[model samples]
Target: MTVNYEKLRRRFYLRLDAVFSVEELNKLRFEYLSSKSGLVRGALAALIQQGVEAEQLSMWTGLLKECNLALARRLEFIRERESNEKLTAEAVDVSYPARPFKVGLKHPLVRVIEDTRKILTSLGLEHVDGPEVEDEYHVFDALNTPAHHPSRQMQDSFYLSEVGKLLRTHTSSVQIRAMEEREPPFYIFSLGKVYRNDWDATHTPMFHQVEVLCVDVDINMSHMRYCVGFFLENLFGCAKMRMRPSYFPFTEPSAEIDIRRQDGKWLEVMGCGMVHPNVLQNVGISPDKYRGFAFGAGLERLAVLRYDIHDLRSLYSNDLRWKVS
Candidate 1:
């Protein structure tokens, strides 16, 4: 079928002129030309050329240029307005609110550590602390970890120096320091940041740990079980636990402590065992005269298990929304 181009063109222009103001018509024209919609632009141009006067044609051509410039200016204005709005939103988000500011409370992880300390203190364990940056001897050698041990490697542990000084891989270093300083007939517990070369959903390169050590006369596996079981029950509000044989350089007959969750699955909570004779001897204590039991575990892992935290990194993320509730 043959198309009546001029008739169609006049009808479109008539409709456009009826509906739109001069400014809006100019915008529509610019949009049509810029979008390269050939039919619309050709139709409008043909109608303007054929029916319009010479002065009117010049006016329309000038209008087209003005429209293009106005469209460009409008787009820039819109972009600037959007950018200003985003800046305003960011400022509002970061600024203190107009309302009275409530003092920020302790972070959830800090509260968890404090609560764990309170529980340990009640159980006759004194809270102790040690350095985050530690020498190789206190962190590894004194703890009975051999030179060729996997934990001593740079990939698994964060070594700060070529000479092998590092961020402590566990708070167990506190126990080593405690043994060196205090002759232990008493119970000791420590909580602090430790570093390892690990990061994932369930691991962090830096995280907290709680370490417990009980050194006294008649301290045996049974005493170890009792103390650990009591602490787990009190901390989790559940009494069900099972011990599985494991290995640690500083402990003999090492067993990993697992507790039965509500789902009937066993979750390994920590590692505990009789302190190795060599470890005690390293600090000049005869293991034959004074036997002890020691246990250590990641505080983040316990918090994750207890609170159903899916990502271990979330504990340290400082995301207020994720942390608050």
Candidate 2:
């Protein structure tokens, strides 16, 4: 039985013309036009065995070629319409408002450190830094701390090796470094992390310190008082401060500083004193020709006081729930 290729072609065109999607149009085209087992392919296979009939062969060839071109045109039309619909659906509105995102607050400790640096720099202190791991000479001997000082005990300081090198307990080691490298008349301010072997509500094994040093002729307690007063007054907007006689290995006539809090409490802030003569001489500075004052305060303590923080551990808690006041 010979298949009517003309009827098959007409049926294909009718289905292809009616298809609204590229998928359906492709199926209709494949039914008659695909290379293997299609209506057109079956006609070609039959033609091969029966041999020649030039008129029928030419007619079938022309018809198959026309069908292929028409099906291609239909598939292209369906695909073009689909693409246009998608473009229209996804068009952006230039006038739409942008979404609002929540901004985060700076850590309280970071804010206090930045604020301190700004205030100190404005008060004639050039900021500097030093290595946290230090030798004993700079940290202890140059600062006038004796061999048997309680600070040298393993229970207090962290030792890296059997030798005297250890993690710096204060930023004063940085002060000694600057004095060793630069001749003064100079004011040096340093802010950095320091380590010790202590932990309590008011203390941590690791913490931050900010210290300032002034070395020049005739630097006295009056100059120290003026510098501290200017810094605190500007910092707390009229802070009331008091100094009490104290002691430190590095300083002569040492005093502990306390500032009146908003709740009428006197909070001890830091330790400061005139630079001891032996400390000056150890750094090759002639004590008879030059003198200086040094003061060191903890940044965590300042942050606590500045923001009325209840717990010192909160500074390093790393909780996203925490926010600066």
Pick by TM-score: which candidate is best?
2
Clashes of each: 0, 0
Q: Report the error of model 1 at residue 150, Å.
A: 0.8
Checking candidate 2 for backbone clashes, the offending pairs are: none
lDDT of each: 0.80, 0.86
lDDT of 1 by residue, 66-154 (tens): 54565566556656767888788877644655887566666667767877888889898899998998999999999888899999987
Predicted candidate 2 versus true structure: per-residue lDDT over 165-244, tens digit per residue:
89999999898888889987999899999998988778889999999899999899999998888888877776599999
Per-prediction TM-score to the true structure, in the order listed: 0.67, 0.70
Q: How accurate is candidate 2 locally (lDDT)?
A: 0.86
In terms of lDDT, the poorest run of 10 residues in model 1 is 1-10
**What lDDT score is found at residue 55 in candidate 1?**
69
Question: For residue 128, what is the lDDT in candidate 1?
Answer: 90
Residue 141 of model 2: what lDDT?
84
